[model samples]
Structures are given as structure tokens and as C-alpha cells.
Target: MSSGTAAGRSRSRSRWRAGLGRLAAGTALLTAVALLPWLSGNDPALTVLRARSADQDPSPEQLASVREQLGLDEGPFTHLVHWLGGLPQGDAGTSWVSGEAVLPQVTSAFAVSVTLMLGALVVTVAVAALVSARTLYLGSRRRLHRATGAVGVAVLAALPKFLLASLLATVCGVWLGWFPSSGWEGPASMVLPALALGVPSGAMIGGLLDQSLPAAFNEPWARTWYAYGFAPHHVARHALRRTMAGVLPQLLPTVVALVGGAVAVEKIFNIPGLGRLALDAAIAQDLPTLQTATLALILLGTVAGLLIQVLRRALLGPALRDGALPALHAPAAFRGRSTRWAAVACALALLTLVTAGLLRDPLHVDTAARLVPPSAAHPLGTDALGRDLLARLGHGALRTIGVAVAVTAVCTLTGLLLGMAPQVGAGLTEVMSTMPAVLAGLLTTAVTGPSASGAALAVCLVGWTPYAAQAAALLEQERASGHMLASLSFGAGPGHLLRHHLLPAVLPPVLRNALLRLPTTVLVLASLGFLGLGEQPPTAEWGRLLSENQPYAELAPWTVLCPAGALVLLSVLALSGTDAAAVRSRASVPVRMSRRSRRRGVQGHARPAGSYK
Candidate 1:
């Protein structure tokens, strides 16, 4: 009876702890949302003020009345209470600019975002899953599993949303004339955006395949099929059930990226989805709308992450699910990292194929020779600006590799610093980790007006925080376990700790994780460029090029396609490269050890490399 009571007490404590964590998260979220009215109205960040703009602005009396109405005059703590009181009742207050109720717009836009998001999921999953099934079972004509995997992965993995959207809009809306170029018209308008949104996500499908394929390839059952003399097709079909063994956990991370991509894609296509509305409101500094949108997206992303967790448990079983989250697992578990070397070789070969196809043109005009159509002169043809598709593609290799490597170096290094900084001060680390990195980004953009410096600054600051938080969390745990004492016993000081112990411990995962983020940063940079925030004209940023040429997307499909294709190629390399690395790692794990034992424990798993995984 006493033991039972102790167990009950422990469970109660556990429940209370969980509730506290939830409360803290809820408070953080609410505080952010509650401040929307005040922040949007009072902060200079919210509005566009031209040169000669008197800072005096609105009259005192009018400003007072406005504050009274908006409840901005109240202290933040008091206002927070008021906002919290209204949240339960769903009274989000009025939009600062429109003077209309905020709830309705939030609801409408949220519905649109969710609907489009769901539709995109359906399409992407269906296509990606089928593709996976085909590669696993139906077998491509070449039977080059790795090559077919690379091709499919390339198209699915590397493409950027805006680039893909622009290309699809051109091909379907221009050449085929099946879809509209811009503006939300109806259900049909959702189709193209959804397709564009779905395309890059097919990479996630490839990732899922990466996790599943190798497992299915080597499973005991697959061996059994071989013993039974089962046909290759039959074996693949039977192997699928087992392949899903590791695919579920990857779905969460994939969906996070997917949802984020969908946000950008919806914005580019002028889809009236929540993502676009949020982005529009953000750019316009429509505080209520923007806040509401951010809140909603956070909710959606959180729920998706949660749902992925639940479904992962259901599908992949508890062992795999536990291995995936809270304690993020190995890159190999997620992407098949070990096989990435082979994937790299395959990727290089395909790149060679792409290059060879271009150089063999019949025109033989150094520049123009590379410009010919899918004819004897140039296989892919000339772009709208009359540049060789192949030459631009080759040159784009620089931009593609350059943007990705630079962003990764800049952002990842920033993230590593942030993540590792907590080793010095836990309290400070926690505070910095929780600071509004995202808010800082918006502030920088609003103030500086989106130059490369501004974009780089925003990304570097925001992107680094999560990584920093992870690093801090890991080090804290290690410290708690007396690992720090052991290091100190080894004559390690701060410098030694950072370089010999922490850096060695944190660098591998952080370095690899940094690689995966390059694609996202490049995409984000492109999106900003499309919005006219990045470098100026003729610099030839892929996104900037897209925006510059958006007007002619109809007349000159090739212009957008060239850059967009470049975007896709870059994305595929990052994602597939990451996954291939994971695959390679898995295959090379000591075969003597059971797979489960080699799987990193929860704490060990949650390294930087695992985020993308």
C-alpha cells in the first residue's frame, strides 16, 4: 500500500511537471499574441514612413483615443492579463488598420491555409509514395536502384518552391495554358499552387524512401523472400510493409519543411491561403493579421509536429518513435547517411550527364551553340533572355553552390555559437534561446528594407537560435550527469572544453545539420529576393531573377525555368545528399550489433544532424 502511494505520487509529480511546461509554452505564445496590438501600433516597425516623415505622426488626442480603443496605453503586464482573459472567449480584438474584428479574417485565412495545406499533403504524399512503391517494386527500366533513386530524389529534393511555382506556372499556364499565372480565382487556382507546393515535398517522399528502402532491402523477411525464390516484384511488394519501419518519424520533420515551403509557394502563386495572408500581413505590417497568422501557423505546425509524433508511434511503433523525437536519432535513421558517398558519386555522374547533354550541341557557337533548343544545337533550348539554357545552368552551378555553402557557413556557424554559448551560462543560454529570434528578423527586415546584409542578418540571427538551444540543452544534460567533471579532471578549461570536448561532441551533428539548412536558407533568400528585399537587379540571384522575370513568365517560360530549375537542383543536392549520408551510415553500422543497439540513445540522438532527419 505504501509503495502504491509512492508510485501514485510520482505519477502526480510527472503530470504536474508536464502541465507546468505546457503552461509556460502557452504563456509564451499568449504573451507574443497579446502584445500584437500594442507592438504593431506603437513600434515604428509596423508602418512604412517615407522620407520627411515627421515622427510626430498622429495627433496626441487622436493617438490617445487610438491607444484607449486598442488598449495600447496600458502597461504590458496588465495588457497581457487583459489579452489572456479574452483569449478563452476568442476575442482577438480589432485589426489596427482595418478597424474590423480580427477573428473572422483569422478564421477565413486559417481555413484556406489548412485546406491548401491538406490538399498539398494529399497530392505530395500520393505522388511520392507511388514513386517510392514503383522504385521499390515496379523497377525502373535501368534497374539502377541508386541512379533511379538519385534521379527521382534530385527532382523531388532540390527544387525551391518559388522557382518550382514560377516554372509550373510557365509550363502549364503559358505553354499549355492550363492554369492562370497569378491571382486567386477559385478551386482550380489552388491546383497549380498545390502542385508547386507538392513538388519539392516529393523530396520528403524520397527521404522516406531512403529510410524505408534500405530497411526493406536488408530485412530478414526480404532474405526470406530470396529463399522462397519470390520474384523481385513480389519481394518488393512484400518488403514495403517492413519498409515503413522507419519512415514515420521522418514524416514530421518533412512536414515541417513542407508546411514552410507551402507558405512561400502560396505567396508566390497568389493563393489565398493562410500562409500567403500571413506573409502579406507581415510585409504590410498588419499587426493583427500578422500576429493572428503567426499564431495560427505556430498552432498548425505544432499540431502537425504532434500529429506526426502520434502517427509515428502508431505506424513505426514505440521503439522507432521514441528514437526519432525528444531524443532525435541518427542521420542514418532519418536519411541513410552512410550511403551518401555513393549518392554523391551518383549525383556527380548525373550532373555530368546534364553537362554532357549541353556541350554536345551542334551550333558550335560558344555562347549561342549552348543556346539551341532540344534540337541538334542545344538539347534544352534557349531561355527568354536568349542565354543558353545549358550555359546558364552551368553558370548557375556557381550561384547554386555559392548561395548554399555561404548560407550554411554563415547560418550554421551562427547556430553553433548560439547552441554552444550555454556552456558558459545556463540562465543566459535559456534566456537567449527563448528570445524572439523570429521577431528580431522581422524587425531587421522592416528597418533595413531587405538587402543581402539584411537577409543574411535575419537568417543568421533566427536560424542560429534553435541550434543554440539544442546545444545548450545537450551540454546541460551532460553537465548534470557529471560529464563536465570528468572533462575538468582531464585538465580541460573553457578553451579545452569548447574545442576538445564540446566542439568534438557537437561539431559532427552541427556540421551535417548545417548542410541541410543551406537549402532552406537559399529558398528563404530567394523568396526575399522575389519580394525585392535582396540584391539589386542584374546580380542574377535565382529568386531575384524570378521576380524580375515574373512579368514575362507567360511570354518567356524559359527565363523562369532556367533559374527555377537551378533552384530545384540545389535543393535536391542538399536534401538527397543529407539522406544519402544517413543511408550510407546505416549500411556500414557494425553488423555484429543488432540494429536496435546501434541506434543512438535519446540524448545522443538529438544532435544538430537529427533536426533535418
Candidate 2:
């Protein structure tokens, strides 16, 4: 068979496999949603009754009638079948809390969410394109500009979405009066939220494109086109397209993240989108609404994934068919000494806070000194309940940072293990990547009840997918490298190759990515807590502290600022540490290569060093 024809057939088979995998994942998700009522260990009818009237003591007959009305008395199989049957006809049942049709509510909210997502996506693409173009214009000679761009992008990406939302809402909305801070009034209100969501994500995409575009420009095809006397813009356009196609797969997870991150943004901005609806339902224990919302989100995510896949294929076209594209390499790191020192300072400050807080009592309430400003006794001030803000923040750090670290560790390990087998791991990663950590938290809260552990578990459930995807991609690149191919020619076994080559090659970069993700993990945990799906009040958690003190910001800004500031500092530390590590890793590569060359020379088989160049 011709190579092109064989490649076409291979793509066809891959599509079939992907279709099957998506179908299986959809079925599993639907089944889980259908069984959520039962999984929560709460009577759906009783829960509905409580939501309807929190003070009412319901009789057995009332509960039974409610169960019958909701069709929850039936087995899960029957419910699943009924739900599936209704989906084709747009029948998504009724909301237990609001007593409204679930379909209309979910659809309306989903439309709003889709609008927000589209707006954010537009911003994401625009920012990425602009940044990439600017970086290209600067070219390789402007190392300082490139370094500044990298740090700027990293900082933007590191900023928590919720924090950004708050800032934009305050400055742009409230202060400047450029936009409304709250409500889904119209397109005008969307500006701030879209910017909040898109800017960070844009920086992330821009960073990727900045790295990829330069590499793409250096490609043989790109050089050939340039040598053909093509217009610079025309050549640049083609390079951009090719670079996007190469990086498109990485954007799928970003889409998933955008959807998930919307939860906090919606809440902060008071946009009645699906994320807010799902969170509300989860909090209210409105199983019917929560289940329907969860399923809708899943479908939306699946469709988005499919769309991205189609776009990627379209962009690649002949290159994909001919298998001409090379596997992407990790971006080179730029050293920034200032960022390193800032990270160290942040870490020390945080450690000092945690150590000091641990030495004091967080829960000790003194009503006489309520809402006190920073004094000699209270370093950070006091909350409304007269609890020392410093004490709470210190103790909260342990809960927040400790949990984040643990989750990051688990995700990294899981990713490393799964990434060893790219075929299986990549598929699984794609499947899980569709479910955002927020949605996962909602589902987890439904099953396990709202707590710190549930929030952590929810994060762990989907968090590893990103790391796994990164590892799988790295593994693919390593496997396709000349060294690995040469080793295979020398009869290296799979075990030997995996132990000596793949693991060593993939581990460091993936670990650095995980370290970079630490702040994000903390953000996610805090988001869950902010939504009341994490640690409840009376417990010192950063998110819970924010949620509780938000209303009292004017009264005692310290209550809000302390935790928020801590989170911001932590984010800075994570970004700086990861970038520093990347620089160190990159710096060592040449030294290691030279040492290997020396060893080869000692073996009397090394070629002239000049030959390498």
C-alpha cells in the first residue's frame, strides 16, 4: 500500500478508537450521574424536602410521595435508561429545590456559560497571537525582551482567576465604572469576567506559542518557504498555522481548565452560569439539579474536545497524513535571578507565618477584641469573631499548603506511573482531562460530603491528567529521539530503555511542571473552599477564610487581605521556583553532554568534538 493510503487508514482506525473511548467515558459519566442520588448516602426525597423547607420535619408518607414524584424510588438502571431516553427529547427532569424543569434551567445557564467561554476563548486567542507576534518581531537577539515576556506570561498565568476577577471588578467595574461588577446584565458585564478568565489563559497559550513559533520558524519547510522569496507576512502566517497545529493538542486541557475555572469567576462576578448553578446545587444537595448540570457540563466538555480535535486535524492536513511533524520538545528555560530571590523571600515569609501561627491558637475567640486592627498582640489583626487573624492565617497555611503539597505529590507520582505507557496513559488522560477539577469537586462533594478531604480528593481525581499528558508527550519525544532509536538498533530491551532512557529524560521536566502547578492546586482547593465544598467555617482554611471575611472587607480588610495576600505570595513562589528549576535543569544539560562525550572518548570511539557542531 502507498504510504499516504496507509496513513489515511491509520487515522481512520485512530478515529474509531477515539470515538469508542469517548462513548465509553460518556456512558461511565452518565451512569455515575444517574447514581449520584444513591451515592450521596442521603434520601433524595428528604433532601428535597429539606431544601424546600429547611425547618420542616417531614413524615414518611411525604418523603415517599416525594420520592415517587421524582422517580427516585426506581432502580438506578431504570433511572439511567429513563434519563438517556429523555435526553433525545430534551427532557432533563425537574429541579428538586426550585421545582422547575431541569432542562430549561440547565439550558439557559449553559447558554450563558457558553457565551462567557466563547468570549474568554476569543480573548485567549487574541492575546496569544499578539504575544507570539511581538516575540517573533523581537527575534533571538533581544534576550532581555524574551526573558521579560516569559516572566510576564508566567506571572499572568500564576495569578489566580478569582483574584483577578475581584481586581477587575473593583478597578474596572466599581472604580472606573467601565463595567458592572456583578450580574449577567448584558455583554457589558461580560467584559471584566472575560478579561479575568482570558488574560491568564492567554498568557499561558502565548507562552507556548512564543516557544513553539520560534522552533517552527526554524523548521526545514519554513526555511524552504522563506528561501522561495515568499512575502514575510505570508511565511509568518504559514509558520503560525503550523505551530498552532503542533500545539493544538495541548490546548484541549486548557479548554477543560477554562470551563472549570469559570466556577470561581462566575461566583465572584455573580454570573448565573452552569458552574455557579452546579456549585449551588452541590451546596444545597439538590441532586436532580446537580446531576443534570453535571451531565450537561460533561457533554459540553466532550463536544469541545471533539471540536479541538477536528480543528487540529484540519490545521495539520497533509502534514498529519504524511507523518511529517516531529514531536514537540519542552520549552527552553530563561534564567531570572530577581524571580528566584522573590520566590525565596515569599517562601520564607510564608514559613514564618506558618511557624508563628502554629505556636499560637487559631480557634481561641476573644469577643472583646473583635475586628481589631493590627496591634502589638495581633500581628495580622483580628476577625469578627475576635479570632487572631495571624493565628488563623498561620494555621490555615498548614491546612491549605499541606493539602496542596500532598495533592501535588500524588498527582505527580500518578502521572509518572501512567506516563510510562503513553498509549494507555494518553487515552486515559484525554478522557479524564475533560472533567475539570471544579466539576470533579462537585461530584466528590455529592458523594463524600463537603470537607477538606473531599476537596483534595476531587482535585486528585482530575489533577493527575495534566501531568500524565505532559509525561506522555515527553515520552513520545524521547522514544522518537535519535539516541533511543540507536539504542533500539543495539538490541536494548524495553526494560533497559525505560529505566535508563525514558524515566531519566521525562522525570525532571514533568516534576518541574508539577511544582509549577502547586499554586494552581492551592487555588483549586481555595476555590472549592470558597464555594463551601471544602473546609467548613470554624476551621482555619484560606478559602474558607476568604469566603467568611468577604462580606466584612470594609469593616476589617485584614481578614480578607491576609489570606488573599498569602495566596498571591504562594503563587509567586511557585512560579519563581519552577522557572528557576527549569533554568538549572537546562544549564546542566550541556555539562552532562560534555561529560558523556568525554566518557566516549575514554572508550576510544568518540568522534572529533567539532563534528557535533
Candidate 3:
């Protein structure tokens, strides 16, 4: 009885500790979010005045009044305290520009976003389920089928969300006339936006399903149930349910990505959701509105993260209690050499295409064949200005890919260097990471004039965080490894350790991180272009083309659809390349042990040159 009581007390203590940890994390997140307005490098009062005054200089009296109204005269902590206190009572303060209450607009926008999110979520779940079911039906023996499906879904996943939105809008609204091109009225308008947002998410879910379903089906219990005369469908369902705890964790990243993707989707569809509103406020430097929206989104994201954690724990409580969760497994694609090669080939082909585009004059306009439809003479049709759609697409592809490559290179290099001494970059990285890439790009474009180089710099500033964080993690792990410790014990200098041991060990993961960030970099580039923060007019950039042809969308649907299609295709190619590189990098890493290598190492007196300290 005494032992049982002690055990109960221990369990209670553990639960209390966990609850406190969660509380601490939540508080930290909220504090950081609240400070975003201060971090944006603009004085709150001045920003409000500028936004309100519409580029005109505000009088000293006007500035003083604005300062008083915003409580800028109060101490920072006191101001933050008041803001936090008001949140629960449904007061989010007032907009800096419009002077209307922030909560109403935020809530109204939140409602629209929630509705859109629900539709997208439903679509993603259904797609994931269907794909999982298809895989199950194909059976584990059908390797070719599974590989093909995986590659296809991965390609689709790689496409930029904005590009997908544009394609859906142009196709459904312009050609079929089934939906409005850019509005959020009626159920029909909702369909295209939902699809645009959902497809990439669906592809992500499908990848998780692909990984989970096969493993679940092959589990001993599943096979036992199969032997007990259960129907294939029933067995599959049982397997899925049993493995759901493992599968569900993957959904968290997908959901987080969807939240970020919503910004571009809302913009493309002209939906006045919180994301679009936030983008507008940020670009215009409407501090109050921007801060309010940013806080709400951060809260939403935090709540989501918490909810996913709770849901996973609830679903797998038995596993947690029993400590039955498995160690992290290698990804399914680790052994796929052909897949990697295929990805490399696709990447090279895309580069070649871009080169051809760079060599031609994409801007050479012909008046006679204006708005011409696809034909042998003028493939992919001509735009309203009678520019060759194919050439413009090629040019856009070159610019898009170039910017993505540049940003990725900068981010990767910066991450590697910073990660080597993580302590130096930790705080700086965290601060920079909070600044949204889209917002930074917009601000840069506004300052430097619309240019791809400016957009790349903006993206580089924010996008480097992930790679840096990953590199730091890898560096720490390498430092802790037995071989690294051995080298240190043998009196290797820091430079020698980094150059000979740490660098090689960290390369694989860094390469993989770079590959993974490519699609997102492209997405940021495209989003900036979509917002008119990319290369100036007639540059033939994909997002720019989408914007330029919107007015003529009704007259020449092909003008919009063609560039949109090209964007999707280019994204597909980029993703395929990423997958391929990931596979090759994973394959290049030595397995924990290989029998033949053990003998070679034992037999040879001399260590190979490549095996330097």
C-alpha cells in the first residue's frame, strides 16, 4: 500500500513537471511574438504616422497625438503588460492606418481563414487516405508502383504553392469559367484556392502515408491478423489504426507549413484572410495592424503545436506509459540509388532548359500574333503583347531558378560557417528567423526597387536560419561522436578537427538541408514576384507574368494558364532534383558497419588518405 502510494506520487510529480515545461515554452513564445513590432526596425509611433499620413510628413502635433494614443509614452514592459491583459477580453487594440478596432477585422479574417483551412485539411486528409489505400492495395511486392507514386507525389509537392494557385485560378476561372479568377465569394471560388493550398499539403501527407502504410502492413501483428482470415481491407484498416501514432506526428510539420503557405494562397485568391491582411500591413508598415495579426497568427501556431502534442500523447498514451516507441528509423529512400540519379538527371535537364532561355531574347515582342493560342509556330501561345509564351516561360524559369540557387547557396554557406561556432550565432539566428522572408523581401524591394537580386537577399536573410540551425545540430553531434572525442584526445588542433574530421561528417546533412530548402526558396521568390517585389515588368518571370496578364485573363486565358503551367513544371523539376540529391547524399554516408569494410580496415596497415584525422 505504501509502495503504491509512492508510485502515484512520482507519477503526479512527473505530470507537474511536464505541465510547467509547457507553460514556460508557451510564455517564451508569446513574449517573443509580442516583441516583433519592436524588432522590425521602425519606431512604432513613426510607423503609425507614416502609414496614416500616406507618405506625407506628419506634423509634430500629429506625431505627439499618435504617440499618446498608442501609449508609446508608457514604459515598454508596461505597454506589453497592458496589451497582454487586453487579449483575453477580445481587445486587440486599434489599427494604425484605418483607426478601426483590430479584433473585428482579425476575427472576421480568422473566420475566412479557418473555413479555407478546413476545406484544405479535408482535401489533404482524403488524398492521403486514398493514396495510402492505393499503396495497400498494390501490396508490398509492387516496388515499381510504389516508387512511381512516390516520385510523382514528391514532384507535385515540390511545386510552389503560389504557382499551384495561379494554375487553378486560370484554368477554372479563365478557360472553364467555372469559378471567379480572384475573389472569395461563393463555394465555387473557394474550390480553387482550397485545391491550390491542399495539393502540396496532400503530397506531403501522401509521403507520410507511403512510409507508414508499408511498415504497418509488414508488422508481425498485421501478418498474424491476415493469417486469421481477415479481409484485405479490414487488415489494412487495422494496420493503419495501429500505426497511426507514428504517422500522426508527420502531420505537425505539414500543418505548420500550411499556415505559412496560407499567406501566398490568400494573396493569389484575393482572399481577405488574416494572412493577406498581415502581408498588407507589413508592406505598408502599419505597426498596430501588423503586430495584432502577427500575434494572432503566432498564437494560432502555438495553439496548433500544443494541440498536436496533446493529440499525439493522447493517441499513444499506452505506448508512452510503456516506453514502447521505437528509435528513429532511416527514411525509406536511403537505399534508392536510381531515384537519386533520376533526380540529378532532371535537375541537369532543367539547367539546360534555363541556359537555352538565357541565350534567347525572351522580351522580343511581335504585334501580329497577339493572344495567339498554342500552335506549332508559337508553342504555349502568345501573351496579350504577342511575346512568345515559351521564351518568356524559359526566361522566367531562368530567373526563378537562379534566385533560388543563389539564396540556397548563401544560406547553406552561411549556415555551415555559423554552425561551426553555434554559440556565436544562436541569438542572432533566432532573432532573424522571426522576420518573415516574404515581408523582408517586400521591404527590400520597396527600398531597392523591384529586382530579383534584392528579393534573393531578403530571402537569404530569413531562409538561412533553418540551414544554420541544422548545421549547428550536426556540428554538435559530430563533436560528441566517439571518433571526434578520440581525435581530440590524440591532440588534434581545432582547425585540424574542423578541416579533417568535422567537415566531412557534417557535409552530408548540410547537403540534405540545402536540398530540402530549395523548394521553399523558390516559393519565396515566386511570392515576392507575385507581390510585384521581383524583377520589373516584361522580365518574363513566372510570378510577374501571372500579375501582368491578370487584366487580359478574360480575353486570353492562355496567357495566364501558360505561365502558371510553366511555374508548376519548373517547381516539379526542382523538387525532383532535391529528392535525387537527398537520396545520393544519404547513400554516400557509410552505414554503421559493413562486413567487407571491417576486414579491409583490419587487414590494411595504412589508413586510406581519405580517412584523415
Model 3 per-residue lDDT tens digits across residues 1-613: 9977887897677456545544454455445444545555656677777777665777788878888887766745675677668888988777767989988988888778778877887878877766566666754332322243555665666656765677678778778898887878877777888888777777756655564455455444455655666667676555455445444544543554455447877877888887778787876556556667666655565455456547755654553443333211223343345555655666676566566556656888889989999887776688888888778877777666677778889888887787566445633443344445665665566556667888888787667755665555445444544444545665668886665556655665456446544665666676677677776676777767766776676678788776555545554454455445544543443342233235434211112221211
lDDT of 2 by residue, 515-557 (tens): 6567678778877777677878788887777767776765677
lDDT of 2 at 450: 94
In what order do the candidates fall by lDDT, top score first?
A: 2, 3, 1
Candidate 1 TM-score over all chains jointly = 0.65
Say which prediction, candidate 2 or candidate 3, comes out ahead on lDDT.
2
Q: Which stretches of candidate 1 lie over 4 Å from their true place?
A: 1-80, 138-147, 170-186, 220-246, 253-264, 318-403, 406-440, 443-449, 457-520, 532-540, 568-613
Count steric clashes of candidate 2: 0
Off by over 4 Å in 3: 1-82, 88-90, 140-146, 158-189, 211-250, 256-260, 267-270, 314-352, 363-399, 406-437, 440-517, 532-543, 550-554, 557-613
lDDT of each: 0.52, 0.71, 0.62
> Residue 368 lDDT in model 2?
99
lDDT of 1 by residue, 49-139 (tens): 2111334565566555555665545655675565446768998656666667877988987776667767777777877776675556533
- Pick by TM-score: which candidate is best? 2
Misplaced by over 4 Å in model 2 are 2-6, 97-99, 126-137, 142-146, 149-154, 207-247, 283-288, 313-333, 416-422, 425-427, 473-492, 496-509, 584-613
Cα lDDT, model 3, residue 370: 90
lDDT of 3: 0.62
Model 1 backbone overlap count: 27
Error of 3 at 357 (Å): 1.8
Candidate 2 TM-score versus the reference? 0.84
